[model samples]
Target: MRHVVKEKSLEDEEEESLNRQRLTSARREALSLYRDILRATRFFMWPDSRGVLWRDVLRENARREFEEARFEKDPEAVTRLLIGGRDAVESALEKLAEKQRHQIQKERGDGR
Candidate 1:
């Protein structure tokens, strides 16, 4: 009985340790994604004075979304959030690039 109890305790400790490691990794990835999204906001362009407003909106949106997910305890949920955020950021970047390309083409008198 004693040996079985000891083995169970060790197993529990190992499981707890693994969960802590996973949580730590998830937090690190979340923070990295948050920073990347904020940094990418700088590339957003808007005509006239609305540029500043749009940038602020983007920043606030990103912060709010991350805050909403701050209490997520499940590793799978955290991973999903990180992946979704990354995809959204990538899509925004692609749109920005496309817009810039169109502007350049327009300036060159090339209609497409």
Candidate 2:
């Protein structure tokens, strides 16, 4: 009976350790996503409708969002958030690139 109990305890410990490792990995991924967001914001040097810098606004929103999700424990939720954040950032950057390309084409057409 004692041997069985010890084996069960060992299994529990292994599971707990795995959970901790998963949490650590999730944290690393979240931090990386946050940094990517901040870096991307720097590319938007223009101001918004309120005349405030878009970079500052984006940084603030990103920080708030990360804070709000800091306590999330569910692995699935964390994965979803990370994916959604990445998609949003990629979409915004792509739109900005398209706009710039359109502007360049317009300028070249005018030049010609």
Candidate 3:
């Protein structure tokens, strides 16, 4: 019985260590995504209908979303959220680039 208890304690310790490592990794990824989103916002110089800078709106929204997930422990949900956020950022930038390109073409008399 004593030996079994010792073995169980060791297993528990290992599991705890793994959970800590996972949490640390998730935190790192989240911070990286947050910073990347902020950096990407530099391109959005336009103002919204509310007269607020898009950059400010984006930063605030990102901060709020991160805060909402601050205590989430499910690894799957975290991964999904990260991926979705990244995709949204990339898509927005691509759309912006397309509009800029179209505008440039129109100015050059090459757009329809």
**Where does candidate 3 stray beyond 4 Å?**
1-8
Better of 1 and 3 by lDDT: 3
What is candidate 1's TM-score against the reference? 0.85
Q: lDDT tens digits, residues 1-112, model 1?
A: 3555445588899999999999999999889998898889887645336546666788888989989999999888888999999999999999889988999999999949
TM-score of each: 0.85, 0.88, 0.88
Question: What's the C-alpha lDDT at position 9 in model 1?
Answer: 85
Per-residue error (Å), model 3, residue 6 = 9.2
In angstroms, the error of model 1 at 51 is: 8.0
The local distance difference test score of model 1 is: 0.86
lDDT of model number 2: 0.93
Q: Could you say which candidate leads in lDDT?
A: 2
> lDDT tens string, model 3, 49-83?
99999999999999999999999999999999989
